[model samples]
Target: MVTLTSSTAAQRPDFAAIANWIKPNSKILDLGCGDGALLKYLQQKHRIFGFGVEIDDANVLGCLRNGINVIQSDLESGLSGFADNSFDYVILSQTLQAMKHTERIIREMLRVGREGIVSFPNFGHWKNRLQVIQGHMPVSDALPYHWYDTPNIHLCTLGDFENLCKQCDAKILERRVMKQDRPIRFLPNLRGKLAFYRFERQNKSPKSTQD
Candidate 1:
């Protein structure tokens, strides 16, 4: 029943796009919620009830100022406090590269929510490819950092993500690769700046059948 202030609704398009992807009136959990923009957008637009988990003190305070419900926690520690299927969706946006155990956190996302959406900068972007050929790290809008100063703990390509999805028993329901802000449909592994996927965890076999 929360509504966005008209001023906040006019801010940016990407947040609008993210808000559109969420199901209306469903529970959501946003991990690494930077500034709580996406959660506030969802609450205002779709009437979704959810809380954001942010570690940065400034961001946590920002969420409070924005009238968003949020929990202050480090993602590296995992989401053990939340029960399985506690939320309809769990979102991780532009924060995957900074995690130490990416796979484990992804699994936790699946366990806590019925479905999960993950978005990250693609290390195989065309510019990055060129940088590798030139023996230097690529610096672009999506990944704007020098190697020594970057907080990214893991670098992954599109192919790597596909393999990881397979290994984790997650089924991709929707995917988008973007160049700048435009969606890229062809050879995304080579041309895209970021990759987004909506996924669900595959059901496991019964214990009797497994044995």
Candidate 2:
């Protein structure tokens, strides 16, 4: 798990970065929003209107305790509760790999909001690759789980995710790769253990009205 920073917000760096991308007073939806920390922080810092969707009972209670508007639902069912462009941003943080229907959920995110933000562990990091070379799955700070008990099922490299966005007709707006609290500038796929992306669906041009 990413460690919380000492800043007043006390959020993980990637969460803070995600917050920065959001505009003040915008409507936001957070998926798998454990404990509602990010949404609460944004409510206080950005004064944004935020809602959370969590499947776990404890987390749903946590969102209530945080005074965040939330609903208990499985993401696998998709975001059918919300209408198209219902929010300014929809976020799925560090939970993409665990999803059973990755493409469908991503499409749902874009469908329900103007933009989507996703973050996940980079399975192609050097440490993971080294472990693979040694015929073992990696056990690291970013992915601290054994193969059998791990929730993550469809882990992928940075390139894999980008290609997926393309296939979904999502336009990439920004991408960031990180190692702990710091951003990685060089050889991100090999060095960075985490990847973050902000994207939106492609728009079709309007037909000409002229005869």
Candidate 3:
């Protein structure tokens, strides 16, 4: 009998902010939904019907114990299981950078869900540039991995992500940049440590599907 809780103050900050964007009773699919914390919070707060897709076995168990709906699967293989527009929203929180097939997964996200929300650490921050100039990989609280051992394989900047979105014909509905959970408005690429975007496909059609 395992259960999860988020009573402490130092818990991750994106759950509440992301919850604000979701409408009540709207269906949601959360990719990489660790321990179902954010899904649980949304259920308790917004009463939205939600499901989680997690790869880790421990996290799958945690989701079950927490009474959250979850599926265990690797993200890089792609999301071909869901139907077109099966959900009102699909969320990818802090998992985009580590993915090898970012473009493919993103396209799948938009295909399976009407709108997709993604958050990732911004690699274009000024400090990262400074570290490169000084000949050392940047290691910050948001991106705490050495270049050689980092899980984030395809890290992208704000500009880089925007260009990818354009290539995918994704319409950006909302954008937020932050420094340690607080908002970052001025010189976001240089100052912001985290970035979030909510978007939808300009044209609605499904390409990849699974039996």
Candidate 4:
């Protein structure tokens, strides 16, 4: 089995932070799970049981190699295969911006799991702003793509994401804005390169089926 320690988790800071939020032995559904690295790490460390959803053919094979149960499917098609509240957490990491139906996906995530976690690049970072002022798209370690080739179609700031969560009736439970592995306490929206959020549907009930 592939083992990930705290030191290696630091390389992907979000994974470490997210792991802190999850309880041991919890069921997790990871969407856009690239190579099942996170899920594999979680399983080895947290003893988590569940599946991953990945669209890419190579990624699905990677998940298999990593000993993860994965569903090969497009996220835009919706997560109808899973029943309501089937898992402890549903995670979408750094892939929310590329989603075509963002709100729908969030709603589905909440409907299928007790809580949801999302992470994305912060478009409001000062470096990105400076690049925009210079009439060129920002390209950094967090968002390493040129204007035309970027997969991120819905780049947004911290504020934009919070507002969208409100619209979707998802209550923000915790938020971490950071530069790589370090937390930015001051002016996070402006200085942070990435954003991580933990949330759940507001007014949700254990027996409720309506989304």
Q: lDDT per residue, candidate 1, 1-211, as tens digits?
A: 3356755645544565466578899999999997788888887788899799999999998888878889999998888878778899999988999999898888888788888898888999888989989999888888899899999878899889879988788888888887755789889999888888888888632111111
Q: Which candidate is the best by lDDT?
A: 4
Q: Judge candidate 2 against the unseen true structure and give its global Cα lDDT, from 0 to 1.
A: 0.87
Q: Model 4, 50-148: lDDT tens per residue?
A: 699999999999899889999999999888888889999999999999999998898888889999999999999999999999999999999999999
Q: Which stretches of candidate 2 lie over 4 Å from their true place?
A: 1-11, 204-211
Clashing pairs in 3: none
What is the per-residue lDDT of model 2 for residues 6-103, given as tens digits with 9 covering 90 to 100? 38344377778788789999999999998788888787777899999999999888888878888999999888888778899999999999999998
Give a tens-digit lDDT track for model 3, residues 1-211. 3332454213666775687688999899999999887888887767889999999999999899888999899987777778889999999999999888888888889889999999999999999989989999889888999988898888889999999999888999999988876889999999999999999998877556333
Provide C-alpha RMSD values for all models, in order. 3.8, 5.3, 2.3, 1.9
Please identify model 4 stretches exceeding 4 Å from their true place.
206-211
Best by TM-score: 4
Cα-lDDT of candidate 1: 0.82
